[model samples]
Structure formats: structure tokens, C-alpha cells
Target: MADDPILRLRGVHTHIGPYHILHGVDLDVPRGGVTMLLGRNGAGKTTTLRTIMGLWRAGQGSVHFDGRDITRLATPAIAQAGIAYVPENMSVFSDLTVAENMRLAARSGAIDEQRLDWVFRMFPALKIFWHQRAGVLSGGQKQMLSVARAIIEPRQLLIVDEPTKGLAPSIIQNMISVFCELKQTAVSILLVEQNFHMARSVGDTVAVMDDGRVVHAGTMADLAGDEALQQRLLGLSLAAHQ
Candidate 1:
């Protein structure tokens, strides 16, 4: 809602059936930069993302995006508001070719050649396997397609979850480069990742979650250099993870 952060969550609480997953999460994804959401397993990081996307309704609090209050908007409406989400599963259509998958993501029903070229530049393998079935592509390629689909259109925000989950070191490095390039673009990013190495590489800012709440919010450089603070918040320093 503010002019700075493209996305803002204040005192957000979410419940999935009987489980209360989030307890007053406060986070901000500043415009035109990458904000890493770091936390341990079951820390409600995924739930927080789902809540923002309207996949899971927040039980209380508010979600604001680009100067609009989107807390009650439906998933389709939320996406229409220029927030693109790539879940942790890398949800590409297995039965469809890479081109087909990309076409589906284009809301206009026609792929933009210029945007396609940009995507191809970031992930060259997508262009190589453009006509191949998505199921036939490797895990890294599928992940690339998923990301390419999200960026096919010009968007204000891109939220990705664990993009480097099963990728090799080389592929992870490629992704790091892609994200670095993305940072220069107009879109801001809210990335939820457990890969601390990738987090340290691409994160400009950070928010650490624990037991469904954001325990720390600060610049990535500060957190990366302070092993003591890292241990207190994350139980291990970035060096340990490295």
C-alpha cells in the first residue's frame, strides 16, 4: 500500500483447518529488489506465501500490494493484480510441451515474442527444449520453465518458493545469475528458500520466520556477516550451512 514496498503483510495470521500456521507475520518486499524469506521447516514460510496469493485465506490482519488492499481478493484477482507466484513444486504441465506451458501462462492468449526472447536469454535450455514435453525435461529445466512462465508477462512482483531445491551446484549458480539480472528489472521478488548459499548470493534484504512469526528483519549483508545473530535466529550461521 505504501510507495516503497511492493508487498506488505502486517500482523497476518493464517489457519489451515485446525492448525494455526501463522502468528502475526510482518514482512515487506521492497520494490525492485529481492527479499529472501528464510526459516526452518514448518516455520510457516510457505503458508505466508499462500496467504499472500490468496490460496490460503488469512484468519486476521491485512495484505497490501502496490498500494492496494488485497487481503480479501480471490486468487485469480490477486494474480490479475500483477503478483505472479511459482510454488515450490515447480508446477509445470507434464503432458504439455514447454511452449504450450508458456502459452498457458500468457493471459492474453498470445505469447509476446520480445518477452519470450528475454526468457530464452535467461534460461537457454528452455529455448533448446521449447518443443519438447515438459515431463521429459530435467528437474532444473522444469524449474526454469516454471520461472519463465511467471516472467512471460511484465509483472510487479514475483514470488518463488525453493526454486533451487533439487538443483545441482552449477544449475543453482545459473539461477543465481538469473535472479541477479531480474533484480535490475522492474519487478520485485519475495523468495522463500532453504538453500542458504543461494539466499546469501541473491538476497538484498531478509526476513527470518520461526514458529509462524517473523523474528528478524534486516539487510542480507548484515545477517550474513553476523554469525552470532544468525545462530540465535536460525540455529546455525551461514558459514555452517556453507
Candidate 2:
């Protein structure tokens, strides 16, 4: 089964300064589908993501990706290993044009026209504003560009953190469609989101985190259907949220 999960974490503990954030976190991102990491604010979801990316080193335990131990690798090294991260901030270069941003994220120093065309299909705004500066775009458009940049090149896994944090309802629906399309591709996705509606829509598997540890893991359909389980684990029913 080790070959099945593209990414695995075991007892991952991360500390930022004197504050202990992630405490013995364990998770698995199965190959070729969306695995949603869901939790309330301050539930250590972000810390867990940062630790996996090697932005924050794990104090104990291990992180394995594509069958290799990457617990101690630096951020750049981890990225080079074919993992792409789209942080919540969207991190687009405000001064750079949309085309410039894509060029920067390509990593190969050259953007492939075919891959770009595919990305444009998924997010038409990027194509419309190709020559425009990233800072001038709307929040939703910026998020699309952030995602487009990540997939401009081939990747084994894509990790996104709270992508729908501040978008409108229509934009959220668009994001749902984007993730759905991404699932059909060869790349796997690990997503952290608070919107249960979006989470249940795109997620094939779900992991719930609380107090820095994963409290539940199962199919998204199970979590969505069980109002009692959702109320207990997530403090609300998924159906009610939708």
C-alpha cells in the first residue's frame, strides 16, 4: 500500500518558536484524487501543511513523498521533488503581468504552449488578462492565476491551502469545477478548506483535524451524509452548510 499514497505523514510534530503547533499529526494523500483536510480556525491545518512543505521542520516523526523520506529536506528541494504548493495568500507577484507569473512558476525557464493552453481552458481569466499585472486582478482571478502557475508544469502532487477563504458564491462554484477537472488529470491533490460545500463536492476522501491531530479519516460522502458525525467532528452539518 506504500506505493498507493503519493504522500504520507506519520506522527508529524511541528513547533513555531515556543508554541507547539502540530502534535503527532498523521495523514495520507492517496494517489490521483482530492484528499480534503478540514478543520476550524486554529486547528493546525496550516501548520500541518507548512510542515509537509518543509517550511517548518517537523520536530519528530517522518514525511514520505513518492516513496522517499523528505522530512528534513528544504523547501526548494521538496518543490523540486514534484510537489507544488499554493498557499492561502495566493502569492502572486503583484508587479508582474499574468504571463510573467506563469513564466516564473514554470521552473524549467520556459512555458510549454500546450500546457498553457490547457490551463487557460480551466481558467479563462488568466488568458484574458495575460498582459495585466497580478495586483490589479480581482481576488478570485488572482487565485486562479496562482493555481494555473502551479500546474504550468507537470507535478506528482498539488497541495492547496484554504483556496476558497474569501471568494464569492459564484467564484466558489467555479473553484469547485476547477478541482473537479484537476481530479481527472494524473496529478493528485491535497486540499485544506473550510467550506464544507466545496470540500464535499470535490473531495473523494476526507481527513478532519482538531487540536493539531487528525481525528477522523474516511470517504467524503460518509462525512457529508452523517449529520451526527459532521456535528461532532466539524461542529456543524455539511448539508446545512450547503
For each candidate, give its TM-score against the true structure: 0.97, 0.98
- lDDT digits (tens) for residues 100-165 of candidate 1: 999999999799999899899999999999899999999999999999999999999999999999
Clashes of each: 0, 0
User: Which residue pairs in candidate 2 collide?
Assistant: none
Give residue 46's lDDT in candidate 1 (0 to 100): 95
Per residue, candidate 2 scores C-alpha lDDT tens digits across 104-137 of: 9989789999989989888999999999999999
TM-score, cand. 2 vs. native: 0.98
- Whole-model lDDT per candidate: 0.94, 0.92
Off by over 4 Å in 1: 1-3
Scored against the true structure, residue 24 in model 1 reaches a CA lDDT of 96
